[model samples]
Target: MNEVYFPYFDPDFDKLPERINGPTCRVCIDNESMDDCTVVKVDSVNKQGLLLEVVQVLTDLNLIISKSYISSDAVWFMDVFHVKDEHGNKLTDQKVINYIKQAIGTTRETHNSAKAKTYANMVFSPEPNNNNEHTVIEMSGTDRPGLFSELSAALADLHCNVVEAHAWSHNDRLACIAYISDQSTHTPIEDPNRLASIEDHLTTVLRATITPTPTTNQPNQQEAKTADFLGGEGAVTNVERRLHQLMHSVRDFEGPPSRTASLPTTPSDSESDEEAGMKTTVKIESCDEKGYSIVNINCKDRPRLMFDTVCTLTDMQYVIFHASINSDGGYAFQEYFIRHLDGCAMSTECEKERVIKCLEAAIERRVCEGVRLELCADNRVGLLSDITRVLRENGLTVVRADVETQGEKAINAFYVRDMSGNKVDMEFIESMKKEMGPIALQVKNDTIRPSSPERSRFSLSHMLKASGSLITLLLSSNPCKYS
Candidate 1:
């Protein structure tokens, strides 16, 4: 008999045997048949995180996906994505295609997985004077899993409206360009302070890092510290084991796949209408098993919706062990198996109600409100600080921000509101545009700073204020990112 080992009990346990063998995943790119775009097709065994993993690889390659079709039977999955390079041309490189195939074909071991290291570099700038009324944001960085999704969530958090976007990846580098507008004004952003906030926030997101805390103590404290660490670790392990047992119990109760084969072949009339409208709905219910809850969500599909939902759950301090997601024809259906972050189940009525209300609010906030704007210009140190100062002087509030820099050029987006919590009017927007015109021109021209006494004093003060403001903004904006 084959020996089965659990990683929770033995940290050095070997992973379970692979279910599929002999090159189960396949990928191919067709450029000749598709006139303006490239068609990339993938076939692989069905498994958790399979779709997300494939997307991460494509995003790293700097390939823009214009359209995608995803289908999965119980045993196998197939996907076809219509794509293009940043320049909107079909892919011509064979080596790049092979790299994608290899990435998707390889099977990942489940245990002792290590996080990939990523380095982020960015630029911030303002769009050039043109008849077009939108600003542009661009970004390039080392690609990692969920990079695109994190970018989308950052943009949504900033209240920036995405007017148009293009993204591509080659090897380990990913690049993206987006044309956006202020959510309040529905025009290009002119307030410098708001732009600065957007740049700083996005830069922080791109360069975010996680480091494990080291345990150190004096002689008197060593014993206590060691005991505490071991106790906490043991508690976590027990909770995880219990959660896994509960999942298995529920699945067993549901019976084998063949048991559902005798069910109805088609949905009723009412069910069809509900699915057709594609209205957003969130449902939370207690699992019959102890220490678990089931979260069911049905909604209109949009970019990064999955990431947004997952982010919200994490913010609410929930641990998710199992999740299934399906999106088809602009509608998304998702189910999550969850418990409190501390491993306790939702046993109280009030807890369940709070979960429902909070989730609904999170979804509603993203879908509604805010004006979007975009900025493109040459990036410089302290540029974000200068821009944010201007916005504060004008009494504008930043609702959302997304910033990206590639080489020396910077492109950014911000969704903002006025002091009164309302969309900005045209007159205010025009005034901002006039004030920002000279700044953009100077940055583009690389004008030398005047060396007068007054100029030196102003520069010193500006640096101090920038440092303080950056710290304050990071601490206050979107606590969920840190949590």
Candidate 2:
């Protein structure tokens, strides 16, 4: 039997004492048979977000993946990617190969330890020439780990197919230009609605990359109140305004709480054990010589866990250099090498402690709060808006939402909390279920009625009335017709 050893950064291990065999990552280049591209083969233990990480590394190295094959059996993953450098030439550099090997071999516990500063401001414009060519997207922002990955992931999520992409970083600022088209039509996205949705989602991802997470050692009532305010408002306009305010509210807090005060107390040993089992732990340490920080996280795995963690780090303004990710059984273990975008280590001991607490709180809040409602319905325009309206009317605050279309069906998931920035109690949950039950049935039975022409006119009138100035102007333009 082969003994498998997990490589961890043990501060106490002073010297190399013994050799232990374990599961190892393998990366090799094959150039003997391939002519147009370089073939890279990778074998490793499979984990969440592994493929995305690998693609990110390749993208950072300015390589293009022309063709790829991926296979995994729940435990192990083997992949082969046919790639080429920017000049469309095979990779022949031994040093680059070594770097790739090191990048893939090192676990997240010890990767991404270098400091590089980057800043980005994004501008999105649509080009519609009626010829179905391409749409160009431009972004400039602070360069950090997984930035490219985030952009690519957003594009993928929005069903945009990338045709060409170029990115460059200098003096800590990064700029990217991409040419993309609609995945379904293979044409430039001409629909205003689809383009707006794409822009909205991409903007969210890009903004997260540049925003810094607020460091709060102790929960400030003001900040919590602000979050609650934003969380409570379900109206689109109010939510948007409060969210803008919440983004600027994070600031460094004064000092750490007293040790006893910082730690949560348990009533009994058995209950304490149960609570510990459900808790999430996030650790941050300095890799001074490597000029980066190391973040180790352990928690129960859930949907979009990787995206949530990366988004949090990016929002906190820390750059990830390298990472190893794994999820097994029901738990997830992630290691990240990170540094502040300013290329400085965490300023104070309290800041480090604050990072840990903030991340733990984020994960806990995500896991414990919000009822998840999954809805499957026939794909229809305006369906999402209707569903959201229902939720808003029911006093449910949508903390998170994901909507995807599969063939003729739409699968939507929403994480909702009550108005008070807390989990939905049983009563609320039951109420929500009762209300959503009919909506779901209507969707399944295709009984949803379309808006009548009179209803449409009435809706337009309502919209105009809500905008007092617009209504006044319209009435003035045609006073006799209105009267």
Q: How does model 2 fare in lDDT?
A: 0.49
lDDT tens per residue, model 2, 398-435 = 43433444455545555554443333344433333343
Best by the TM-score measure = 1
RMSD of each: 19.2, 20.6
Per-residue CA lDDT of model 1 for 256-340, tens digit only, reads 2233322222332434576446666888887766556889888876544554465456546676555666666667777777778
TM-scores of all models?
Answer: 0.40, 0.36
Off by over 4 Å in 2: 1-52, 55-273, 287-292, 301-347, 350-368, 420-483
lDDT of 1: 0.47
- How well does candidate 2 match the true structure in TM-score terms? 0.36
| Model 1 lDDT-worst window of ten | 220-229
